[model samples]
Target: MEKSYQAAQAFSGDLSFLQEPADAVAIRHQVLILHCLAEGQQPISISWYKNGEPLPPSSYIQQLLNGSLWIRNFQKRQRNGTDEGEYSCAAQNRYGRLLSRKARVQLAYLSRFHRNPQPMAVAEGSVARFQCLTTAVPKATIIWERNRTELVTADPRFTLLPDGILQISGVTKDDVGVYRCLATNPANSRYSDEAWLTLTGSAHLSHQEPVILSGPQNLTLTVHQTAILECIATGNPRPIVSWSRLDGRSIGVEGIQVLGNGNLMISDVSVKHSGVYVCAANRPGTRVRRTAQGMLLVQAPPEFIAWPQSATYAPGDNASFSCVVEGVPQPTLAWLKNGKYVEVRENTRLSDNNRTLTILRVTYSDEALYQCIAENSAGTNQASARLAISLPQDAPKLPEKVIAFPITSTAIQVAWNRPSPADTDGIIGYVLHIRRAEDPSTQETQEALSKMTFKHKLMNLEPSTKYALFLRVYSPVGISRDSGTIFVTTRDIVPKTPDFSVTTVNDTSIRIDWEGAPPSSTIQGYKLEYRKMPCTSFQGTQILPRNQTSFIYYDLEPSSLYQIRLVAFGNSGDGNDTHRFVSLRRSGKVVPDPSPDSEEEHKPTLGLIFGVCVGLACPVLCLLLLFLLYWKRHLCKRKTNEGCGHNVQEEKTDQAIEEERDRNSEEPTELLSVNPTNVAEADSSLGRDATRVKEDQSHEPPHPAV
Candidate 1:
């Protein structure tokens, strides 16, 4: 335990006394020691004091190595001075010093008897008493002796009170004696004059009520000090004394003691001990009593429970500083700036008791070191803090690594990295600027963005158009520089309308089937619109989900020409419309529909009719020539032998040619056909037939252009 205590004390830097001096008495010429031990940081020194002043250097007195004062030769009073007085010591280190509790030191001695025992003659079978008193450094103990020998009062009738009063009840001839009082202490002893006690005629003792000789008086002291309340009483049978709080509180015995016949003493008093104390003296075994009361007031030094802290804030912001202290008496507080008294103005205000100081719309001039001073009857204390005003130079930096991209044909998403918290301490929000690239005549639009979100989407923008974007961060003081510009363009061709075919399902309904394309993120849905021809206005437009590729229209009018339009829609807007014309027949027969692109072309004219006529006549003429050639060939086969059978080699060649024709006829052949819509198709067909005939004559010699 001792080692642990020493270890703790060695590291503790605050001055604390391990031992303090206490009240003591010394014999004349005897050695005296006043203890004053403390622990703190290294390099500690000790000093002694006497009677509220520094002790002068002397050979008779000196401080010991353990921070104690030693008086080699103590004296009660000398020609020059006395060694008896209030003495205290202090221990000092680099941190601070602490003074030990003051102790009263006095020399012990017994003085001559101030009042001797008076000779008394008491009646037999009655009460008789004798008294003795003296002055001593410590309250001396009194002893009674008869005939110069120690008196033994073993009889029930004999009694000795603490105040040196000897009482004898039922006194007979045996109680007669010559008595003397003695006062003794550790220092010395003294004897009082002797007197004779004799028996006389019958005597009567009167009963007296309890009467308070001295009562407690009002007093005030600081906390942790001692308090004494005096209460003395006298009565025929000696009153019994007790103490209590006038407010009915218990006088706790922790630091309480009864001193000298009935006085109350309390040690280490605190604020809770401050109250009116009641002292009562009651006659033995009776209700009769006498009471006295006095008030005690405890005060404490000013100590801070809260202190102001240094802070930095942007200009035009309200700043507050607070200081709170506690004490027995409410302390008065004052404000200071830079070690000087603070001047109050329209912008500056102080709370009740000057505990809080507030500055409104603080500017550069309001920045300074601030202090709060608190004072009371016990002691004074002060605390300090600093206020700083932020300037434009301290504004947040521009956003880093800004980027932008298109989310759809008309929407663009922008994002950027946030600056570090230390650099953007006072930033409130961000501002984004957007405008068409290379178009100074266009108005730039600005959007205010929340500081918490680093990404923002710009909607309702023109498709296939480029935009320039930049960012700026702002604080209460000012805004930062603009970040580097970034460019992004919205997509134009995405979510294109899919081609669809319309077919009659019934007399009143038509079903549409469309080719599906790969899914795109920008595609939202599809819109279908249809209208009767010649009206030029669509009716009953319907929106379908993005994944749907087919739709059925019901309750359509029969025998009517209707135009249908389908388009894909997304965040940007609807894409190009696909238009088709459908004709419904009233007879319930569905006609084959022409290609959607052919519906826009004009009908054939007179030139197309003439070309069609020539094309029809040429085919008929070819058939007629083919029939005539066949008949002529039959006749020639019969008449050819007589006139043409002259050369044998010629006949053989003709037979070979017939054989060649027969072999060619075994192969299949194809004939050309045409449905001429214009003169160009008819001419194209005639040119193709001529080219084929020329190719057939390639085996013969080349013919001239006739």
Candidate 2:
């Protein structure tokens, strides 16, 4: 059984997370736990992170075996450390890694009200309102108290908003008493400043429209600072003042409050708070109001979110650096080299809003420290990275185990394994050195090859010829020393005929069947040529895959003779051809010629099958007999050498041994003794007996060598 393992499955269920940390609010000095559990490949490790950085191990903060973070005596504020900010966890294994959702950890505490309930005088039977707002994490709950007693909020006459505002309708004399806000949270509870609510008789009170005594003025401040917009108003029965953004954005209650009757105070202001503010003063129970407006501009200095990373590259390669900054008004970006501005040209340019700098076809002189500067109205910032140029001194190692095979009479296939990964770093491509055995090195032809290619074919060469070949590996720096030379002899141009039989399938179709060749990568496909008999010119050709051995030729003239040819092809070129002539009658009956020259065509289908079987088995028997003869001869030579005390033996190099092994595995010994240079003796007894089948087609004799 195979062992099962899974990497970080990302969102897949294999590496499922049972629980993840969530936003939490804990009281100071209390223990807090954040959960992160995952299941995946064995030997998985879990790590905790805080504020986007790894959290250092400490006694105060510990990670449990189950991948949960436990904080002891969690501190909201400390001189050295604080238990706050965002927290996340990661589960990792050798296969992959995954990160969990980020969770914010905040101390739970409610601050004293920036603005407490103030004394107000109003007429009885009119609506009355009171406001109490405080800053708190996880939000604080506020309850109204009448004379130290919890007010009945269940009464329909009272309404409470999420922001700690209280409203009362049909105020009676019973409402006249000391009123305050009691705020409670996970940390502690406190009461706001007490204020007495007084009411006069409706008839005795004089009504007046609300009026703004002062309006907030425009203010500007930097980030992480505070801004105050003052708005004071007065009216009979007192008016209620509220704040809003002119752009219709929320006047968020966090770090924001109304102080001293109607003043707006914002703490820890950021660029997001830069907007126009509108303050409205309205009389209680009526829409009569006055308004004031102010603009608060918050500015921030340029800060980098993405920086260029250092890298190394060879000459003629492209190099690029990117720098990204975020600030108010979207900071402008610029590029510099070694503290000086870089000249912009066609080869060196900026893109993507001037945030990216690209140097095309970088040369050695282009190597330098690249800097990116961003400037805005607020401030400027810069970051830099170094670009190092490398000119390798060592070329790539030579190709491994180079060997060549005779693919055809005029073509040879050369293949080699790539060098080990460690020796291939700077490799750009390969070069083949080809020459005849008797030729000078200066006369050798060089063929360039792609770095990724491992096998190549050398075509259009002389048959029955000897050639010497070697390989050279090239890199950006230089070329490697030539590999050991290997010699290969091309085969004589003698193509073997395919044994096939043609049978009529219909009035216009006849199927040709042949035995398939043994599986070999070199066998590319097969070609089928057919036409009417005695025409010399073929009509058309059809190519079939190497695995296919049968084809049907259709749309032939009825009662007409047709000649069909089938031949196998390899990477080199076409092989021998088998031709057969068939005649179809008007009744769709097929007939074969019975001429003495075409005896095999007159055989039945069974006889054709037997012939094919015998033909294939003959090659195997011949190969076995040749191996036996070679082995006997080798044994006899060894015995004779031992008997004569002749221990002389030739030493073979690693390259020579590999070449010998490849040659024995790929090539078969030819039986004929014919020499390429002596064509006059080609018809000798040895050639006639060695095995060359005679083709006796009626109109065409056997094809001789070209």
Candidate 3:
């Protein structure tokens, strides 16, 4: 255990004695000496410490033998409040060695004061007077102070009457705080009890600057909404603040009601309030000074003009919505479902009412109208936008036989004649979202519709690539319902019709393509088909999944001029059908003219010709015959001639023939005239002719044997 200091050093003398702490409450003490016993040695000195600080850096109590040397009185110590503890008395010899033990005195708050003053209260708007009314047994004299400064000592604002009355005339609120009175007599003076003075009067400015302020720096209100306005100001004497409407109207309570503060205020401010507002401050001391300039802007509420005004959000799905609002006070956005704040991961959930609100990993409970409110010192503005959470009533069911254009395939044009009746909130838009069909993440994209129409034409699809598509409807009342899927494939041909009627139908179908090509779009094929009126099964629908211009209706009855029209389908299942009327584009036939060389006499019997005939006994014939035809003819003729003239020619021919034959044969076959060692040498090579079969008798497999 650490032991505290007992008594640093003690003052003692054999001539007399001093009693220990005799008074428990009264801490002042004195050492009484009946006789002076100290002579040869020396008198002792007393030192004090309020928790280790010398009582006085200069004065130390001395045990003087004469009356001048004697310590007639002693006092306690003080800290921030006058009274501090830990006093020690020390005694030492001139030899700077031997001394007596020490004595300690503990003092508190006001200390063992020579005197203390009492209360002196005064009325508002009146001259204030305070005096140090204190009495020490030795009859202490009086002095005054305010803050830490000596009141009557030097301050011109303060004066002391010979009668000891400390007075300040016509005192304003500036003199309202705590003040202290000090009574001085000789070595020590007691402080009067701390007294406070408050003056009642008009407002006064305490702080400097033309501070500009608005209602509340922090507020949430709806966009394009109305709200109140105000500002912040500080001063003494309580300056009066008033808020005024731009349209001219006085604000705040008046007279007997104490107009309280004079900050101007306006109710229901809209875009009209988006301007500079001046806050006027007036006080008795500080004249009328208005705020430099403060601006108030009224913004609009969350009226969603974003990617998705309404959508179906599934559990653990991402739902992003945005809104732009305007109001006097800027708005704040908070996402709530069924009326409660959402707590998602920091990044996944966000509120930037200034622009948009995003919610990731959205759940069913997150379906509700999110309110983005803007508020200011005046009032609150609010706006609400709705969201929904739902899954398709059921997965899509592939449509029945769809008669699309030959250019359009792998798809069908569908407008749900029948959809799930469970759609209560009505559908907001249809989602033609398609995943990799192999991935697990349910990513999605939604195409919103302008109306509640059952028909929607989708385009740009990969042939034979299956997709999972669902529709979700929304109503202002119930935004959480998603309709079941109505699976409709896209036409193989790029469908370009805004909407159409099929006409001009016959055994062979034909239709004019009118819908413009899709932006940067490509198509693969088209499908064509037709069934008799009221047929049970599209009797037979021709799926011409290619870009076939016209298709013959093979399924129609023979000799039956059936009504038929073509519908073009692209690879992505988007298609457009020709008018229902079967209008055949009478195809023009061409007749070739007779050659001028007159091989076959002109059989003008019936036909007249208009097309030019292209003939080529050379260019044309070249395409008709192969190089092998010349080889066969030359090969047979070479054997018939052997004269030197014939031989020379035959030799050239034969040489050419031999060279050709040699070129055709591989080294292995030519090796019949060489040594076996040479054959072995050729076989060892890694060249194509060696490693692979030699370029000879390419038709026949080569053998190692010569």
RMSD of each: 40.9, 27.6, 41.1
Of the candidates shown, which would achieve the greatest TM-score relative to the real structure?
2
Q: Candidate 2 at 468: error in angstroms?
A: 49
Candidate 2: which stretches are off by over 4 Å? 1-24, 29-54, 63-73, 77-80, 85-105, 113-115, 153-161, 211-289, 294-316, 319-354, 357-706
lDDT of 3 at 301: 35
For candidate 1, write residues 38-147 as lDDT tens digits. Answer: 77555556677787677866768878888788989998777768988888665544332345555778899887888899898865655566778788887788888988
Q: lDDT rank, highest first?
A: 2, 1, 3
Judged by whole-model lDDT over C-alpha atoms, candidate 3 comes out at 0.37
The lDDT for every candidate, in the order shown, is: 0.67, 0.67, 0.37
Tell me the TM-score of each prediction against the true structure: 0.34, 0.35, 0.18
The per-residue C-alpha lDDT of model 2 at residue 529 equals: 61
Q: On lDDT, who's better, 2 or 3?
A: 2
Q: How far is candidate 2 from the true structure (C-alpha RMSD, Å)?
A: 27.6
TM-score of 1: 0.34
Quantify how close model 1 is to the true structure by its C-alpha RMSD in Å: 40.9
Residue pair clashes in candidate 2: none
Q: Clashing residue pairs in candidate 1, if any?
A: none
Residue 533, candidate 2: alpha-carbon lDDT: 43
